[model samples]
Every structure is written in C-alpha cells, then in structure tokens.
Target chain A: MDTLLSGQLLFAALVSGSLYALIALGLNLVYGTLRLLNIAHGDLVMIGAYTAFWLFTLLSIPPVVSFFVAAALCALLGWAVYEGMFRRLLANPGLAKRVEANSLILFYGISVILQNLTALAFTSSSRGYQYLDTVITWQGVSMTGNRLLSLGVAGGICIAALLFLRFHLFGWELRAVIQRREAAQIVGVNLNRVQPIIICAGFAIAGIAGVLVSMTEQITPFMGFPFTIIAFVVIIIGGLGNIGAGVLAGLSLGLIETYGVALTSPGYRSILIYGLFVAVLLIRPEGIFTKAVRS
Target chain B: MKALDIIFGLALAIGGLLVPLSGDAYLMGLVFQLAMWIALAQSWSMLSSTTGYLSLGHAVFYGIGAYVCVLLTGVVPFGVALAAGAAASAVFAGLIGLPVLRVQGPYFVILTYGLAELVRNVVMRIESALGSFGRMIFMVPSFEVLVWCMVALGILATLGAAAVRHSALGAGLAAIRENEVAAETVGVPVARLKLLAFVASATIPGAVGGLALLRTGYFEPAQAFDPVISFTIVTMALVGGTETVRGPVLGALGFTLLSEALWSSLPQLYMIVLGLTLIAFILFVPRGLSGLADRALGRG
Candidate 1:
C-alpha cells in the first residue's frame, strides 16, 4: 500500500501511461477515419524499433534523430499499402458492410507477413540498445534518463496529435471522415486524399512510439502484437473514434496496470488488463468515455 | 454440381480414412493434421460463417478441452475424458455466449480475441503456480488410434456443419447475419439461435483438441492456446469458401498440403507465402477455392 502511493510508482505510471497513449492514438486515428483495423499496427512499431536499433548499431545514429527517419519510412509504407491493398477494398460500395471484417482479415495477413519477414531478417532474437541510461533523482523519485526522455517525447506527441485534431484544417477533415464517411464526402472532404494521409499519419505516430519503446525495453519481431492488443484496449476504454479520450484512457489504464501489478505479482498483469478489457466491453460496449465524442 | 461436390468430398474422406492402414508414420501424421484442421475449420464455419459474427477466439475452447482432457486422462477413461472436454467447452460457450454475442462487428471480433488471450494468460498463471512447466501425457493412444479419432471428428464436424447450414436454425442464422435487427423484428429467436450455434460450433474443437494433445503426447498452455490457431481457422474458413460446408474441407486440404510442401525447406518463407496467398485470396478470390470450384462446375 505504501509502495502504491510512492512517488516512484506515480512516475512510473505516468511514463507507462504516456507510452500507451502514444501507441493507442495512432491505431485510433487509423480506425476512426478509414475504419481499417490494422492488426499490423504493432508490427509497424516493431519495424520502427528495429530501424532505430539498426541505425544506432550500424551507423551510430541516436534514436532521438533516427525516429523521424523510421516514422517517414513507415508513412511511405502506409501509402503503398493503401494504394496496393486497402484502396480496392474501400472503393467497393458493394462490400461496405463486410469491409471491417475483410480489412481485419487482410491486416491479419499483413501482420503474419511482417512478423515472419522480420523474424527471417532478424533471426527472432531480442535486441536492445543503451541510450541516455543515466539515472536521475529529483523530488524523492529516480528514473533512467532514457525513460524520462521517452515519457516527455510520448506525452508531447500525444498532445500534438490532440491539438492537431482540434485545430488543424486537415485534422478537421480527418474528423469529418471519422464522424461520418458519407457526410464528409458530401461536404467536399476528398476521401481518397484524406484517407491516405490519415493512414500515413497513423503509421508515423506508431513508429514514433516504437522508437520510444526501444529506448526503454527489449524488442523482438513478435513484440508488436501485444502492443496492438494494448492499443485496442486503450481505444476501447477511451471510446472508439475519440482521440482526446483515448489519451486519457491510456493513462488511466497505465495506472490501473501499475497499481494492479503492484498489488499482485507480475504474472497476473495480463489477466488483470484483459479482465478489465472484457469487463468494460461487457458493461459498456460503446466505451467508458462514450459521451466524450458522441454527445 | 452439388452431387459432384458431395462425391468428391466423400472420396477425400475415404482416402483420409485409409491413411492409417499404410503404417507410414509421416503419412499418418500429415493425415492427422489434415483431419484436425478440417474439423476445426468446419466447426468454426458453423457459427462464424453462417452467422457472420467472425469469432477469433475458437482457440479458447480448444485449449480448455486440451487442458481438461489432459488433466482427466489419468483419472478417468480416455473416452470419458474426451467427452468431458467437449462438455466443458459447450458449457463455456453457453456461459459466455450471452454477453459476448451481444456485441457485433469489430467489437465482437476483438472481444473474442481478448477473451481468448485472457484465458491463455490465466492458464499460464495456473500452470506456473502449480509448478508444472508443461504436462506430459503418459500411456497415450497409439498414432493410428489418434489419427482415426481425429478423422472421425472431422467427419462428424463436417456433417454437423452441413446439418446446421440446411436446418431452420441455419436459415435463422443466415437471416441474422444479413441483418440482426430485421431478423429480430421478424420473430426469429436471435439470441437463442446464436447461443445454440456458438455452443454447437464449440463442441467438436474441444474433442479435436483432446485428440491433438494425445497425438503430441504433451500439453503446453502457450502452444495449446496460440492465437495463430485462431487466425489459421479464420483463414482456412475464408479461403475455402464460407458459404458451404465443403469449403473448409478443401481449405484444410489445400492449406495442409501447402504447409507440408514448404515447412521443411523454409518455414519463415512458408508463412510469408501463406500471408501473401491469403491476401491474394481476399482481394481476388473473395468467394474462396470452393467458390471457384463451384463456378468451374457451372453452378454455386
């Protein structure tokens, strides 16, 4: 109980919360605008981590600078994916009802391809690199500088994303698409252009988050699916299609996880998280933050 | 065309049944996998394809059955353990069906996936707490016996899927799939039928899982509840053609053969090829291999 209230746990919760929000925002953005459930979202993150890892390992580029490169790569990949695969599916009005399921299956395939390809390339071993690992102590709390940096970067990106959605013209167009696809088209929001942008932005955000993850944790080809699941839980908690609430919900889930794990052993962590997800789903299918965006 | 399909399906089943007689270990093993996947995919198709709910959590039922059957094998007759596994899964389906089936679309899909992962973690924790890394089943049935059991299950599951697809329940399920609200408005017992299908579709996988554990002579929670099993089931159902019972059989046959061909030489490459093939199937051959067969034979 004492440990639960300690400043260290609080700091840890904040950092983890920021990470969750970072991962979930990208997934929510893609799903909100395009209705594309990119189960491969996590694999995108994995790619970003690997990108940073290789850049630092081979070329000695710091993750701070390499993340942008990785994010750009991801954005390009997203554009190609949209053009090559999802565009045809989305263009078919006859498939409107089954689009979600179809996209889910398509992305599941994409995930398999990405994971196995990464495994083939990287040999399925875990990889990590040290950067800014010096411990810092302040106000009765201490953490590695890398973790502190990750927290700041993740939090900053999440805020920038929310602000972009709230104030930017393209952000408004993206929201228009999310709220009502047909209505957005009627209002002259060019879906073909807006959709690719949303997908790219979504991938870039996940890429950035992946870079932060690599800073603080070990990564492997298979690390992405759990993050995908985490993103789903976060978006569900925050209310689907609501970006602002997604951040808040991500933070809340982080606290829940931190405190829940503190109360029990580490092994019970997944059970607790998934239990919360199932409970929220059964009790409030729309979301805990349903009124945030809908009303 | 329908009669031709039936004959073709019967021939394949008879051919599968004869695999054990050859006494070749490799052939029996491959046939067992074919039968196992056929049963799993066919059972999955019964609920997901007909109803369009698209469950990705079928692995939970399979895992639970394997766990229970493995635990009870020493305590009870093997047949009883298998039945107990099936019954346990049916009960689990019935219990979760009410709240689970309430949601629709992507919610239903993710919820099911999350629940399966949840069960997996729970089982993992239990195993660790019990200090059992993974259980090794002793006095397991012979390879031929296990393959025969799996083949029997495959036939039963295929028959059950066909029976469901043609029955009043199947019609009601199709209506629900077309539109749940309208189906409910028209006096269909939507909830009851959905639950029945969910439970029915769940039973065979349980028994099939038990047979799988026996065949392997081991039980590990991670392997038993792997989400890849769920993904493969969905892929096979979609690839085979979900509209008819014959789709799953063909899909299982095709997928198993493909995997066998590629797995030994290059496993990772096989997965990549599978992923690409699945993508191609979705984009171009949405109706699946069975649908292509239907068209080639002049009718669907």
Candidate 2:
C-alpha cells in the first residue's frame, strides 16, 4: 500500500487524468452543443494520432509541430463530415432523430474504412515516437518530461477553451444555438456557419488529445476503442454536455483506474470503472453535475 | 389466403429441411448457420423493434447462453443444457433490463452497449469463468441431429414472433414503444411489459447460441460476443423490416446470404460492404425490406 502512494504513481495518475480530461472534454463539447452522439469521435482521435505519427515518421517533423498539424487536419475532417453528412441530415425535418442513428452506422463504416486504410498503408503494427528525452527524477521517483508537458498543455487547452466559450462572440453564438436553435435562427444567427465551426473545434480538441495520448502510449489503429469507451464513461459521469463535470469525471476515472490497477489486475480496472458508471447511472442518471450549459 | 400462407410456410420449411440432405456439407453448414442467424435477428427484432429500445449489446445474452450451455453439458445432457442456457439468458436479460430500461432513447442504447463491453471485459479478465483459453466448445452431435435442432429452433422462433405479435402483451409492448408515459397512464405496466419482452427475446437467441456452439464444436469470446454480430442482427431486422412477425426472418435470410457471397468474393471488403449497405438502408429504406416490398407490390 505504501508503494501505491509513491510520487511516481501519483504523477502518473495525474498525467493520465489530464489526457482523459482532454478526451472527455472533446466528447462533451460535441454532445453538449450538437446533441449528436458522434460514435466516430474516437476515430477522430485515431486519425489525429495517425496524422501525428506520419508527420513525425515520414516528414521528419518535430512532435510538437506534428501535434498541431494533426489537430488542424482533424478540424478540416470534422468540417467535411458536417458539410457532407450531418448538414444534409439536419436539413430534413423528419429525419433528425433518424439521422443520429444513421450517423452511428455511417461513422462506424467510416471508422472501418479508416482503420482498413491505415492497415493497408502501414500494416497492423504498433508505432511510437521518441522526441522528448527529458526525464525528471527526485526522491527515488522518476517521471517523463513529455508526460508533464502534455499535462501542462492539456490544462492550458482547457483554460483556453473555457475562456473562449465564456468571452468569444462565436462561442456565445454557438451557445445560443445549442440553447435554442430556433431562437438563434430567428435572430439571424447563421446556423449553417456556426455548426461547422463547432464541429471542427470539437474534432480539433479530440485530435489534440489523441496526439497527447499517443505520446504516452503506443499508437495503433485500434487504439480508439478504449479511448471512446473511457470518454463516453467520463461524459456520462460528469453529466452529459457539461465540460467542467467531464474534467472532474475524467480525473476521477484516471485516479480510480491507476489505483485500481495498483490494487488489482489491469483487467479488473475496467470492471471497476464500469461499476462506477453503473453506480452513478443508478443513483444519478443526470451525472454528478447537472448545471445547464451556459448555452 | 390463410391456406395459401400455410402452404407457402410448409413449402419453405420443407425446402430448408431438404438443403442439408441434398446439399454439400459446406453449403449445408452455411444454410444452417443462416437459419441460426435468422433466428437471432428475429429475437433481436422482437425486443428492439417492437419495444423501440435499440440494444447494441444483445450478444451478451447470446454469449451467456453459449457459455452456460457449454458449461452445463458436463453436468447434464445436451438437451437439458440447451434449455438451461435459454432459461439462464432470460434471467440475465430480465436482471440487466431493469435499470437500463428506465432510461429512454439514446441513453438506453449507450448503456446497453457499455454493459455488453463490461460483460466482455469481465469474461476476458476472469480466466476461471471462461477457462484460461477464453472459450470452450462441447463435442459435436451428428449432422442429422444438428439439422433437426436447427429446424426446431427456426420453427420455434417463427412461432414465438407470431405469438408475440398477436398477444395482449404485444399490444402493451406496442403501446410502450409508441409512448411510455402515455402507456403508463393508460394502465399498461411499462416496466413489466419491457421486462417480459426482454426475457422473451432472450429465449430464442439463447437456444440458438447453444445450438450454434454445439454445431461449431468451438467458441471464443471474440466470436461469441462480437459487436459485429449485434450489428448484423439489428441490421437484418431493420433492413428486413422491424416490428413485423416475418420481417426479421426475411432479414436474416437475405443478410446471411449476402454476407456469405460477399465474404467469398471480397472478404476484405465484407464489413465495408455491410456498412455501406446499412447506410443505404438507413437513408433510403428506413422501414426496411417490408416497406420496399409494399411499395414494389403496390400495397399501401
């Protein structure tokens, strides 16, 4: 038990929590604003990771630069998805709800397409990068500099996101649309313009998170499944559509999972996470926080 | 009309029986597997379509039945094990459905999907439960016996769907599907009806899963609890037509044959094909094959 309280484990859990928070935040943003459960969100994360991997491996780009490039590419992809798929669905009055279900199938198909494409291009082997060589060791505890850097970056992103939503005009319009789509439309708020931006921003966040996660973990085409599941659980726990709650839930999950792994086998950690989800769902289906989004 | 329907049904049944006897072993196996899939699709439709609760985790029940049957056969005869597996799956369905069924729409779908993953992870981690090897298969029976078992299951599944579609419980389920609060206010026991549908839905899949496990003489966690199976079953139900007695069976037959053909020709692109097909069905034929048939036949 003493070994569990070591600074290394604590730092590791915090770092993992930061990354999980990033993933959860991406999911919450889309779910909150769009009311669309994008099952392809995880695939976006995978795409981001793959993009970064290719930039670093093929183009000889630095990790940090690759991360931004990956995020930008994902944002573009998100825009295309909205313009091509979701926009058409939203245009139809009767097909709105059906669109959500249909999108699951569509996105899942896209996911398969992307995964197979990656497999065809790169083969089904794991990949990694070793750009950051800094390591900090103190009092018999060691931690990687890259992890600390990712955590700091994630924190910065979260703060920036919150501020953007709080102060920016476009963010305000986005919120307005989410809160009352018809009212926003009545006010001449161009939903057609705003929705694509929101979707792009959401995908960008997920892509960045993907890049960050890949730094700490191995990159594989199938890595999105666990991320998707974890993010979904986090969003559900934090109260769907609430960004702050997602962060809290993600952090809590990270800590819980870290300690859970330390105490039990890694296999049992998932069960515990799911048990927490079921427990929360049974007790408070609305999640730990139910504050309405400012939108 | 009733006489014609009966005659057609008998002819179809006889055709299915003759396939195994006259067809090659591989072809017969494929036909049998198709029948099993049809049974699974029908069971899924009974719950998802009629109840409007799209469960993305139904493989949990199927896997449970398969695992239970495999385990129980050591202590009991094959027939008893099969029944036990079905009963056990029903019990599991009823239990899991309790908390989940409370949620509406997408929440229910997500929760069910998560629950299925949880079950899969639990099974994977608990080596003792599924054995260290992850799956265990029982000894296979003779081809004739296996054929009879599958035929009996197909008939039972069809009858079950027909019964559910016409029963008082079916009416209540339909009401709940239409509007839960309204159904509740109108004296329909919403929870009870859902639980009944869920449990009843489990019976055919459980039995068929057990039979499938016996037929293949092997089982694996990945094979038994694949999300693809759930997707395939739901797709068949939706593509064939949901909330109709014959829709799922028709869906199963069509989907399985399509899948086999695709797999044989373009194995790598089979899933992609399925995905595109699903997308087309969702976009163009939301009501599935039955709707298409109705349109083509000039029937309202």
i-RMSD of all predictions: 0.9, 2.0
The models' CA-based lDDT, in order, is: 0.91, 0.77
Give TM-score, chain B, model 2: 0.93
TM-score of chain A for each candidate?
0.97, 0.91
Native-referenced Cα lDDT, model 2: 0.77
Best candidate, TM-score: 1
lDDT of 2 by residue, B1-300 (tens): 335445755776777788777747876787687778777887886778887888877888888888788778767888898898899889898887788788777677777777777787777666555356755554566776777687777777777877887899889988987888999998999999898888888887888878888877776766777776777777778778884666776677777787788877765467666666766676667777767766676664
Task: Give candidate 1's error at residue B36 in angstroms.
Answer: 0.3
Alpha-carbon RMSD of each model: 1.2, 2.6
Tens-digit lDDT track of model 1 for A1-295: 7888899999999999999999999999998998888899999999999999999999999999988998999999899999999899988775556888889889999999999999998899999999999989998899999989889999999998889889999889988888888889999999889889889999998898889899889999999998998898999998888889899999998899998899898999999989988988888877898774453
Residue B243, candidate 2: Cα error in Å is 4.4
Per-model DockQ against the true two-chain complex: 0.85, 0.49
Candidate 1 CAPRI-style tier: high
Clashing pairs in 1: none
User: Over the stretch A245-295, how does candidate 2's per-residue lDDT look in tens digits?
Assistant: 788888888898898899987768778877777667666778877664434
